[model samples]
Target: MQKVDAVPKTNKSYTVLISLIVALGGFLLGFDSAVISGAVKGITVYFEMTDSMLGFAVGCVIFGAMAGNLLAGPLADLFGRKKILIIVAAFFTISATWSAMATGYTEFIIARIIGGIGIGGAILIAPIYIAEIAPPKLRGSLVSFNQLNIVIGISVAYFSNYFLVNLEGESWRWMLGVEAIPAAIYFLSLWVVPKSPRWLILKLNNVTSAQKTLSKIGGAEYAEVTISEIQRGIAKKEEKGKISDLFKNKYATIMIIALGIAFFQQITGINAIFYYAPTIFEQAGGSTDSSFLQAIVVGLTNLVFTLVAIWLIDKLGRKPLLLIGTSFMTIALLMAAMAFNNATYNFNDDTLNKISDTEIKIALADLNGSSFDSQAALFSEIEPKLNQEQFLDFKRNQITNFIQINATLVLMAILLYVASFAISLGPVMWALISEIFPSRIKGIAISVVGFFNSLVSFSVTQVFPWELSNLGPTMTFAIYALLSFCAILFVYKFVIETKGRTLEEVEELLTRK
Candidate 1:
């Protein structure tokens, strides 16, 4: 390897600026994800959705993301990273506008899926571009800029939802539409950032242009060394990696670690918590206003703890963080399950009075003063009294008023869970994925695992509404808690420490028999 310290210090500030601008895509991805939580109730009412339809509406974004994950790398390879990013920004802008304006369920879903495509592309490409341009010392931090932006976007979406929740007549439209402002900004901003220098060298064999872009990022000497390395890496791979290559015997360990981390990351219910935070709080007997407010707290807690994770990840190492995070995640989920388990529902006069719907109020009048130990039991008692629509309305809209439980404990448990996730699986999983794959198989391996990750995310989000409706919150949380425990054991046995090692060193360590 060649050293390039002879020139003046590299233009680190310029490099940081480029990374931040590229990372703005992450902001849109996060905003698109969480903003829908506030819209869930409104859309359900407007669309007249059943449990399954509601789940599809909310989880459809990940469906589109699956397609994006498969296509983005190939598309970027054909054109350039910058162009695909511009296209992603365009998708976000269109999705936000179309979704807000959509009057039909099909139209609204189509719009949301468009944004999901942007999410799939942005989440994968932004970090790749940042890593390609950043100096080795700054690479990890610069790539992390995307993850940090994601949490910031999540917090901002929560605040945006709260402020718009009180708007009259379809405030959900405002919540979903406001994302266009940032999307447009990101679209225009892409024009300023250069194409990936490595792409220029590898695809076009335009060393001069690659060096020019790299020179602006660092300096002439830095560009020279970087170009040589990129070319050498490309030369060593006589054939590009294919999807079939990932199944080979030597890559078995890599596949196991990558796919396992990807599976556990979503199956443990982080997205379920984030995408449905307001709804979860509402289930614990909170008012709509309080639920939205508490969701903002969840987002803020996630943001703070994510910062903590970044600071401690290299210091604590990857496997330890996964072990610690998954363990605490299991405990926090159990705490939530226990809290919901201890809850009892009583429909007193005061609770009945809180029901605004006249039919629902009258229907539940007979059940006043009757108490039930579990949601399933209470729902069963009420199931025969009302018709299908009435029962659905009672369950979705009116049940919150009749619950008597420790709201504080549920809130605390959720906050702890979010904190634990942010510090461990949230960032650590992506970091480890990037480290474990050999450079030859890195692109395809990431795509395969990323697609699987989206598939799991879609399943969790899709089933959550149905779970809440059928199995009740306690059982739903218990299932997640069980999965979290499994995640801990998987990490302890299979995951290796990647801290302070070069990518080559980490690859060699993991690949060795």
Candidate 2:
């Protein structure tokens, strides 16, 4: 007879099989954020609306976010994580279906808010839940899956909007509604994924059920060790957090870091471009078709660069990536701001209506492989007319600007912003959220952090259109770029490295500090 080893199964396959459902929440979050880009155009047309209305319509999701995040922490802690997630899935399904069927702007806005709430929680919870459950060796990559799902969702939404926008009638509504499919999938996926053992033991005081779930994920031997670690955490946890507890200098710092990151992300003004890039391009000198095409490009670049961050986070480590990315993005934003500044003009009359002639010349140049020369010639000719003209033609410069710097360069800059975000703010902030909090109060802190993050999202999304309207693109972008630099500094000075550490170890380090 031979003794056999009883080490827990660490098969990538098993973990992945269970994780498939958990990641669905990420998918839903991404889909909901982007589906609005498509709806904004049709909704504006359908409702005979304008920029302010469209802006409100698009940003309304943050309202949902505010509510979702407010409730997500207490609910998760009170009922356990999986139960809250199941509730989130239901919200997604309902919101998506209703959004597609919305008759008026009010209906649509309400649905998006409802849907946004679900996404806000899922976005925050999915990664944390995944991180807490995975083996230490696989945590980063496994958690990165949450982000990967989000990108996929954004990508799909872009593609969906593209396909749906051309449909004969109310295509935008269809685009909004179609997301219900994934929402349903997410709800269904939750059926199989086990509850977080740590949540179960710590909050529910159910060590046995937690052990069984842990054993299923990691086998008996690993479950025993996992249970032991979770209990240690349970012992370390003080009275669950009070709002007053956050006032303590130590916890206050944690809350500030979280809120600071959230604020940094918003003030970067990425949402201005995201929610209104088409309009900005239109202002810059692009046609509806070109603007839509450019919007798709932005989404693709966002997805690809996010993938880049996911690949590199573990390899490059967090600090260097954040600092380097912030620098690159800031430069691009400045370049864009300058480009927009150069294109600024004050045409006074129906000149925009008359720019057909100029577009012809630009088109001829394009047809002849001399596009740049002709385009430059057109802009040089038009700039003075637009700058000087008062009432003869108010629109010529706007239309001409589209052909000049609108589509390509502006998109390049915005993509740079997204790239920076994907690498620095996008993934890293979430990583920090999962990392920096004390484990005892991690859920409450995370929820509060997410609440403030959503607040930032709400503020950015709500104010960007107004700011862009008043401040103009160049100034708006420059300001955002500057804010991003400040964010880079914030992290470099105050934040600590959490990569490659166990949750337990990270908590110990934080407390020791």
Clashing pairs in 1: none
lDDT of 1 by residue, 151-236 (tens): 88999999999999999999999999999999999999999998889778877889989999888877877888878877776776
What TM-score would each prediction reach against the true structure?
Answer: 0.95, 0.86
lDDT of each: 0.87, 0.72
Q: Model 2, 279: alpha-carbon shift in Å?
A: 2.7
Candidate 2's TM-score reads 0.86
**Over the stretch 486-508, how does candidate 2's per-residue lDDT look in tens digits?**
88788777767777776777777
* lDDT accuracy of residue 300 in candidate 1: 96
Report backbone clashes per prediction. Answer: 0, 12
List the candidate 1 regions with Cα displacement exceeding 4 Å. Answer: 1-10, 218-221
**Segments of candidate 2 deviating more than 4 angstroms:** 1-10, 344-351, 354-403
